[model samples]
Target: NPRDYKSYKLLFGNEKFYDRSSNITLNYEYFYSCIDNMNISIDQLMSSIQKLQFMVVNLNSPDDDPQLIFESLNSTGVALTDADKIRNFLLMNENLPEQNKYFQNYWQPLEENTHFEVSKFFRYFLTIKNAQFPKISNVYDEFKTTYNNLDFDKQNLFEDINDFSNTYKMILECNTGTKKIDVILNRFLELNVTVIRPFIMAIINDFVSNKIVEEEAIKIVELVEKYIARRIITKTPSNALNKVIATLYRDFRQFQDKHNNQYKDSEVIIFLLLKKQGSGRVPTDEELIRNFKHNDWYNINSSYRSYIFERLENHNHIESLSIYEGLKNKDYSIEHIMPQKLSSDWKNELGNNYQRIHENYVNSLGNLTITGYNSKYSNRSFQDKQNMEKGFKESHFVNLNKLPARSDKWGEAEIIERTNQLITSALEIWDFPESTIHEMIEEKEMYIYDGNETFSNYKIHGFTFINDEYIPVKTWKGLFVELFKLLAKIDLNPLIECTKIDTKIGFESAIFSEKTDDTE
Candidate 1:
């Protein structure tokens, strides 16, 4: 066997066996050394391999679920992906000719267009249809269920999936061939907001289908950007955003119905997002400005911080400079005008409360600027930083201009003044959407829940709690349970205390006792 070197080479002569990038040669060498060290010759190795038994499975009937059988196999082979299973589920049931047709026409091309991200494609694809995110592990199950529910033939359904996947590919690549749309898409990607993809995909689909024009599509993307940007600036929790965004298309449809289908699609989206209450509300300009003044702009996430400054610096410029590229090439960095670690000259300029001033204003907006030469300005005094080459005085950035002229000294006062100026610029860059609801409102009456309400033949349309928009409810008990659920989420102890029998609070029986079997 050792003498037959040519045959041996032919047997294991695949290029991957020796290719460095493949890492196959390293593993193969180790395996060969182990075989030699164990006194196992080529004959013994071949004999051992021949003795190994593989359990083969075959369905007794053609109707048996190949997907189930494939899943049930316990072979120590490479595990199948959700996309693989879904593909098998769809095609395994068909005849060989049909399978080949579907694979060639739909499945293969879908995978290729998504760059082989069919699993994620299915998850986001179903999220738009189902109005909720399906767990990655449950994607195949979710797909099967939805596929069964819809009155779609295999060809039509595959076409739909392929169509949506094309748009999704555009979003993932950030190359929609439209500069305005692509810019916004890049911003979303930089923000690392994968949650908004389904919503964006739905919007793009509408545009291509002629349901909305290119202008309206761009407007919707901008609206989404404002909603997300304001929330980020205000430090809102993003946990509930998935549900809100996933349901936007559905909500827009409902809004259209209520308005006798007269409102534009963009208007309905704005209405729904603006009407949200609590943590999900589209932050007002006042809130954004207040937060902008106090936010630790330097320590914010790098992407968000860059996005903020880039928007400000290039705002309304005839030719915008690439702040992202400059930062990448080390041509620019976030410069602290007052310097992070103060020099003695800077200390003297800041005065008696220097430590307090440095601690408070060091990372805030006014104290920060982008400079091409950050190392040269390290801990320099106010006048040196202002008057040096490529300094505040020499910089062309709108943010840095007029900063030297603001005052001769850098201190708490100057930072506050600069922050006020930047806040004015920010207001222009990320302005809140103005509401035109009065012109669009119908003559329908709405109700708000109050404690003293009595059920005297009053039919429930919907109710609003605190700042929450109109939430539709069917029965009085549904409203009561929902209110208590919201209260319990805030603090269960308050509700638990109320559940106990207490004459002082005018409770005769336990209202919400867990032990009680009464449905009421």
Candidate 2:
């Protein structure tokens, strides 16, 4: 237990898990299973394994980073995971009593709750605590580098991580216990939106600590739900989600600071989320409608279709199919009313516009549905396909599939009709909650004045210039012009004399006309 993660889990695992991989059975059972597969006697296998040599690495000074030692020994092909390296760094140097104490109190529970995904837990922890995202490949190094410079309480850091990991597991495993929250969590997992975990962890921590009420926590999570779903539905660039989510913990705290911490937690989250514009913006209803009609969503993404069908299928009911459970993800498949690989029968149904129709609707909402019998009755003529078992007519997913089933013939007209029907239902499913959105404050464009102010040369927003670097009456424009004039005697102007302009903030367009001591 005072050793590495493999042994720590075995000793403190309550007989629930075995070495390194956290297998639930005993370590001997695993070795026996390997022996059974190899068809070798246990005695001979033990003899051969005993002959294999291993090295025990020691650090002469506690000042030596175990991380360096790990890298040196890892060349022997027994490399540790990022999770293992982090735990080793955390516990390797601690004294014996505290070592086992932290292991039993924190590390053991972390492994059990996260199902041994301690690396992912650490990633989310770092993202929230650091107010920025870290590369998963160097999680241990980033954590180590940041901590050495940060003025934080070390024991408090460990305890906070211990607490946050509990809620983190709830979010990751979708076992948050509150039905409303779990539904949102499951939807996030279904969409493969793990990037939001760090932000959600902050929210859940606040809720668990009673910094905010349960209602407020649910509202914030729901806002995150809308923010992500709208982006997916509108086919927004996927790269932006990581940056937006990474700094949300930072943004939320800044909001509280600016507002004197008086604003409702939910409102601050909603306002900041709605504040995201350009690529990071939550797509509006009109944009969602346009994107739904024209976007080649099927080709762009397949998971959303299943998510869409699953939600819309149960939209009306008080209780219906749960995608989190085995019902939807397991039983239903993304069925294409018009198959992606074209067939003659489906082509005739499309009529003269077969190529055009198929191209437009191949992966769109109108063409796709969640069905049980996808392979059994795929790409056949509509009447024949509908009459078969698990037909669209009998399909429980109604909004998209049922419309196509009811249509007399499948063609361009039918596809357009079905897309419109889907749009009507989808509007309610991914709708951004109505909020009094804060208007974005525009930057004031104040022209710099160079009239009748005598001053010694000074740094203009940190761009230092000497006394009278330009003519005494000077503004930023004139400052640039004066420098350009001096450099014009050559064909190539490689050396720059003045600092590049600071465009966004604290631009003091100044003058040296008023010369005085302490002129600022």
Candidate 3:
């Protein structure tokens, strides 16, 4: 028996002599045996038999093209799926792990270099898709580092990645046979810590993909609103959460405005929450109103807060009225007469250092007071507003400054003079109580410096040969006369007003005129 086994093995050792004809014969015999002995139907037997034959053929024919093998297998009436074929082919290779690594490394660069085109690498990855898993820990580490390093302006990067992760998680939930709602909710809670509204929207969008029908999306949004409300009630309130909600409400409102649509259900809930709480709900609104009503006028009915919200809403600067109630107190309601949002011309005149002044002085209620005509005074300069108010005979009740205007164009000397006037007026308003107004005035005076001679070059230079008794040199009269000559050269009228000159230089000053030649 041992001799017979050795003789049989030696006879079959000539693998080069084995051909496709012999392989097919072997496969046919195996299929017949499966059909007869396994009690399976001929189709089932044939289906089960082909995959084994494919593996054998692939193994024996070392130089056989993979594409040809795939095509042949596909053409055959076989039950083995594409995934199964790939798995089997990978299992047959001794260096499968090394080959996979080589393919992944090679393909990554090619795909990235080609701008992520659907190339051979992409196809290969798809073929061996199950073998690849994301390095979530590494990804999260990088995300945390990047998030921590981001400046305020660059915060959107973390937001985008968070959104993508949320989307991926939603997909995983659908396919994975597990209920990990807690994990997902925790992730959402962490995301809420970051004020990134767009990322939240992206997550919502992804979650509501093809799985959610149109009507169901509406239901889902309602559920999300409820969830947000519940979380606000249970969780510790965060400013970041409030900002995210505010931003989302704003974006939704913009969408509604542009499309001429009504506010969505979720947006309405968010708006309600914003109005009720500065950021998120703490105690219920009823409890808050009841507790604060007796003493807190600001908390009870925030008139000033409502006014700001109304103004912002009217201007379309903010889409929704979320902070309407939060800003409602006497202390908070003062509107800045010199609004922080300055015009381009004003900003240019005020050096970049003006930001500090704006934050400290302009944004404060002391510098802000309710105006009867907020829209009309919106972008008007302080001087312009003063003129308008005076002409209208309106009481400038909230006096942030007594000066006629705040001007960036003014030099340090001019600023000091204005500051002195403002302080005097402020003292008068405060009933001239023993105040530090004088000290503040003195401090502003310290900023003043003597004018440099460099400014002299900017002045017009002129000389006038008048009657020999009076030789004028660069005086106002001589300058005007020279200016008239320049205008005359340009064919412009050289009309001079004796009254204007008298008003400017005094009536006692000599008045001179050159008679015009009508023909010339």
- Candidates by TM-score, descending order: 1, 2, 3
Candidate 2 lDDT (Cα, whole model)?
0.71
**Candidate 3 or 2, higher TM-score:** 2
| lDDT (C-alpha, whole model) for all candidates | 0.77, 0.71, 0.38
| Per-residue lDDT of candidate 1, residues 375-418 (tens digit) | 76667877777778877777777655577544688789888988
Off by over 4 Å in 3: 1-203, 206-208, 211-311, 314-335, 338-383, 386-520
As for model 3, its CA RMSD to the true structure in angstroms is 31.1
lDDT measured at residue 514 in model 3 versus the true structure, 0 to 100: 39
**Model 1 lDDT on a 0 to 1 scale:** 0.77
Reference-based TM-score, model 1 = 0.78
What tens digits encode model 2's per-residue C-alpha lDDT throughout 91-194? Answer: 87778888888888888888877777888888888888777678767788887877687677667777887888898888877876678898889888888878
Superposition error at 422 for model 2 (Å) = 1.1
Best model per TM-score: 1
260, model 1: CA deviation in Å? 6.0
Model 2 residue runs over 4 Å out of place are: 2-78, 149-152, 322-330, 339-355, 387-389, 434-520
Q: Number of clashes in model 1?
A: 0
